[model samples]
Target: QENRITTVQCLSGTGSLRVGGEFLARHYHQRTIYLPQPTWGNHPKVFGLAGLSVKTYRYYAPATRGLDFQGLLEDLGSAPLGSVVLLHACAH
Candidate 1:
């Protein structure tokens, strides 16, 4: 069977994250949310307020001005099973 995913459009990025955080906090078994390093300043607060433990995973590589693929893999691989990870994607 294919996995099912849900999507919702919100007024803003902050609002989207807030809504997602709250929904996940209530329905998902995982209580932790892993954000990419160097995420928005208010991310931690928003997720925390939703009762989810906020953590970060390596994402950006300053030296190359690109993704730290290896670091990202290591950090994510070490994360607890069922943890939620928020990844930023470019639409254009």
Candidate 2:
């Protein structure tokens, strides 16, 4: 087979997210980051370390083990304008 080239750099998801958040916080003003409920164990810490205030929105439902669509909508509706909402890549 012909040779193929690929690049791989191993970095923790939490670390990457935190770094991104920090950049945003430094560059943006009045920006808020919303994290889903029951998100990654370190999500809150990651964003907080970035100097951004992290808020929570309904995401998971204990009974259904799925997303709470209505709850999410309600939270979004309540969020102030220019807020940054984070959603899981493959929540569905």
Model 1: which residue pairs collide? none
**How would you encode candidate 1's per-residue C-alpha lDDT over 1-92 as one tens digit per residue?**
68989678898989988999999999999999999988878999999999999889999999988899999999999998878999878511
Candidate 2: residue pairs that collide: none
lDDT values, one for every candidate:
0.90, 0.83
lDDT score of residue 57 within candidate 1: 91
Q: Per-residue CA lDDT of candidate 2, range 1-92, in tens?
A: 78989554437887668767877889987557998887887888888878889899998888998889899999999999888888898784
Q: How big is the positional error of residue 62 in model 2, measured in Å on the Cα after superposition?
A: 1.4
CA RMSD per model (angstroms): 3.0, 6.9
- Candidate 1 segments whose C-alpha is farther than 4 A from its true place: 1-7
What's the true lDDT of residue 52 in model 2?
Answer: 87
